[model samples]
Target: MIATRKLRRARVLIAGCGDVGLRCVPLLAHRAAAPRVIALSSQPARAAELRAAGTTPLIGNLDERRSLRRLAGLASTVLHLAPPQKNGDDDSRTRALIAALSAQRRSVARGATSAVARQRAWRGWFRATFKSSMRAGVKMHAKAIKRPSIVPDRVPGTAARPRQIRLIYASTSGVYGDCGGAWIDETRPVRPDNARAKRRVSAERQLRGATQRGLLSASIVRIPGIYAGNRLPLARLQKGTPALAPAEDVYTNHIHADDLAAILVLAIRRARPQRVVHASDDSDLRMGDYFDLVADAFGLPRAPRVSREQAETQLEPMMLSFMRESRRLQNTRLRDEMRYALRYPSIHDFLRDFLRDFRSEANAQFTITSVPVESPAE
Candidate 1:
């Protein structure tokens, strides 16, 4: 009887409950049904923080497979916000997460407690306690709530729904690589140039194949630069990190973190199967101009600009790698299909409003005029 209820609850599991994932928790309850939110954390230390944020914390490491068995059949809707590990061309973390989520129900059968003795002495007891605790909560969430599907009225793929677990993956727009500053959509073929993007491509491929095989219904959301009041270019400006000059600056894309959190919530049901949507805003600005906007807003000095040639010698490899790629994303699908109206439509729009609280009217005017930006409409 308890096992049966487990199948019903655990409605939404947020794999990576970091800043963006934390932002997603309340929105999930607000926009959709108030399904229980379970957060998966590798560190047990974060259990308190996760609980404080109104999510039931389930300790499971994506790097380790055994710890994830409890996650099997735990959530009907999964928000995969976990990123790939650093220094890899493939996302082993995603691979493990998929394996665990798709694992057989019987893999974690009762009376498995004794099995822990076979592992290394130091870590064995911990793994044993972890899995046993998950078993203790096998009754799942108290009672299943009435679900409200996030279907868009005008979207074509509403009908013919497949009965499978829903997985909404937060993929990066870097998968498209450099488009020579062209206005591109989802139809553009992916040409991942960096190891970072290659991992994302691998994740996309795995999700699409999973959907095809009916393992799970996956929705891929391609996101660009995510910024919020807390997440800004303040550090770079303070460090005086150089940006490319106007002549050599590459076009950049952005989506406010709050807006992104909202988009993820909407994509839970509105997004089509194996579909990709850009969570980008209509901010048509160069990299340097963007720095200037933030600098002016907070009354900070703008970062020094260097030409592309000079940047290679001055900037770190990571910064230079970002400078190499230049493309503008089209978010028509996000607006039309998901029907999500942006709360912060553009970086400029957000900065303009932010300036109100940041500085005086006289200073705000100076900030707006300080940065010269090109018109970019997504």
Candidate 2:
């Protein structure tokens, strides 16, 4: 109960409070002792939505260093879901945030030192020390006489220890580039092939750099394709885009949206200092096969299959960028080290529930809209 109360008093901040961050709010808020939740939003228009969902939203832009000044010493736990600015190799935003946090830590350190010095220099210091010594002696005497010794949880001044903010950053698995469909773990060296993936690498480096300087403890979660009922490629499938043929197909990974949110919260709470883990599920389907499965579930026609050579012409460059990689990620660290059991262990399991809810909602909407209006008191 005491632990729960302590957690309730904690402040957690979510940067880039989009779909995933919003989903995480209830998981923390509905606990026996709810913690304070704050979300960062670049758009002021979203403040009302954030507040409605029980999170206090702070408007700030990552690109503008001046805007991030307000985030100093704001929360003890931070989920950094914001992406790097486009068209840049370096993530200046993350660097700016780290600088702000370092400044806050230094300020707190100075204050703590001053407080200790003032206490030692006080006119009543000797008297207070004598009283404290006497009280300890009396407690020891009482324990020696009639009770087993019990150690105190913490010393008094220790309670005023400087706060340490922990950060959990969301990165992309594309940093691995093409792995020839081989099974790779977090230990594998990153070899990003494109600028988009390179940007993620830059962000990862920034956080690790901050970790090295004792600015913060951070965890990096490398993610693959993220899908939910609403986030799926249903529209692309409907557009009749061509996927690679089975013989030429590339393997891909995925994580359900809710599972990703759960992983983020888990990382925030349980991540080791400077740890990196993959946020991928157990599904090991080829890219084309995965699309076919979803299309079948939705009763839509499957995407047309073409050889890689043919697909180059039919598919957009952005879509082709995804197909160029074929790597299976090993998530042993996520399971063994962090001990996070995936709620949606596979894409199939997620699709089943997602399709069920989607159909039900569609049916309800159709029923409401299609109902005929009757004449009033005819």
Q: Which RMSD does model 2 reach against the true structure? A: 10.0
Compose the digit string of candidate 1's lDDT tens values, residues 191-234: 98888888888888988887776668899999888777666778
Candidate 2, superposed: residue stretches over 4 Å from native: 1-8, 109-161, 359-362, 365-378
Error of 1 at 312 (Å): 1.1
Backbone clashes, each candidate:
0, 0
State the weakest 10-residue window (summed lDDT) of model 1. 369-378
What are the lDDT figures for the candidates, one per model?
0.77, 0.77
- Cα displacement (angstroms), candidate 2, residue 109, comes to 4.8
